[model samples]
Target: MAKKKNKKASPNTIGTNKQARRLYEILETFEAGISLLGTEVKSLRGGHVSFKDGYVSFHDGSAFLVGVHIAPYEQTGQYDQHDPERRRRLLLHKHEIDVLQSKVDQRGLTVVPMKMYFSRGKVKVQIGLGRGKNVHSKKQDLKDRDIQRDTQRQLASYK
Candidate 1:
């Protein structure tokens, strides 16, 4: 018998933060380029990225991604290994960065990384500006989701 290979040709999405939608009300979204090391990119391609605590922050007139974890590539040598928790710089137009900064400062909003994916062979991140949802609103959203699910099941049964 021949051994099987589990490797996929290519994956569309690298990672996603599922809690972003449930914890915050997204106001705006922007696509930004991420600066990654060679090994980090390989790790991402292998589905080893995490976004649970990832967020975007501005410093020195530039944007940086914080808390996003990319596991080191398994084949990398010890001398060339990259830090999993190092802050990565984000590439965006100066005007966009200014706008994001102003909105975040004035409205007390947060910038969170919603998803990471490959676009034309380049890694990109979808950043969302969001306002934290309160407990009551979260409950309402859960209730609405349940109702929609129940309606979908009913419609399916009727058909």
Candidate 2:
């Protein structure tokens, strides 16, 4: 008998924080694993998560995902329900944590959760270090995007 080979599948995105991209100019991003309870995982699989006001925070040499809401698993018993707004720990190396902390403390950059997805069988969060964009910058970004879209449309029509 021949041994079987296992193939890896592409990651499945659970949710994204669109507001973060629009409101902040991302400078750097890091992928970190998230700690979740059984019910939380189930709820996430069911696409019951909100990224509103979600961001990363460092404390005591550890990173945490805060202000994100993961809805409770609907079929779970009341006793087994998990808190929807708990601050979950983010799994990152000591060096990575230190780097993030330093950047935050020194540069005054904010760490926000950009995306959440399942890589292999585990959940991962893509955290971004960013500075908040001013209103003028945000408007300029919108104008640039509109111009890019018009150019693309004209080129597509020519094709």
Candidate 3:
């Protein structure tokens, strides 16, 4: 008889924007509900979401998530299919929206989607208020990461 491999499953993480941390200095984060279509929610549950090049924008005092791609559900018929890159509304309190609007008005500060995941059976997005990192800062971050990695490796070998 063959032995079964029982692997531990990770907590549900639909997708994350790895590039966001590298490109931006995130100052604060917020968890906001996403207004998703039926098909879109199904696709996200199936782990078909992309945050690459995705950003947040506001209009008429409402926040919108733009550029994030949620692949349509494979089983859904054409008539019920949702657009892959539609602008989805984000549910935030009025005060939160006002704060975000003010921060975005500052020079070089903007909002971006950091992660998408399911929470308590509902799809949610983690958005961040960030400033774009300059070249020197990026280089410094890379150097610090390298140093940390080296120290961890040395400690592990000694142990």
Tens-digit lDDT track of model 2 for 48-81: 8899999888889999999999999999999999
As for candidate 3, its clashing pairs are none
Work out the TM-score per prediction: 0.92, 0.91, 0.91
Error of 3 at 14 (Å): 0.8
Write the candidate numbers in order of decreasing TM-score. 1, 3, 2
Clashing pairs in 1: none
| Best candidate (score: TM-score) | 1
- lDDT of candidate 3 at residue 137, scale 0 to 100: 100
Q: For every candidate structure, what is the RMSD over all alpha carbons to the true structure, in angstroms?
A: 2.9, 6.3, 2.5
For residues 1-159, could you state the per-residue lDDT of candidate 3 as single tens digits?
A: 999763324466788888999999999999999999999988887788888879999999999999999998999888999999999999999999999999899665889999887788988899999999999999999999999999999999999
Native-to-model Cα distance after best TM-score fit, residue 121 in candidate 2, in Å: 0.6
Best by lDDT: 1
TM-score of structure candidate 3: 0.91
Ranking the candidates on lDDT from highest down gives 1, 2, 3
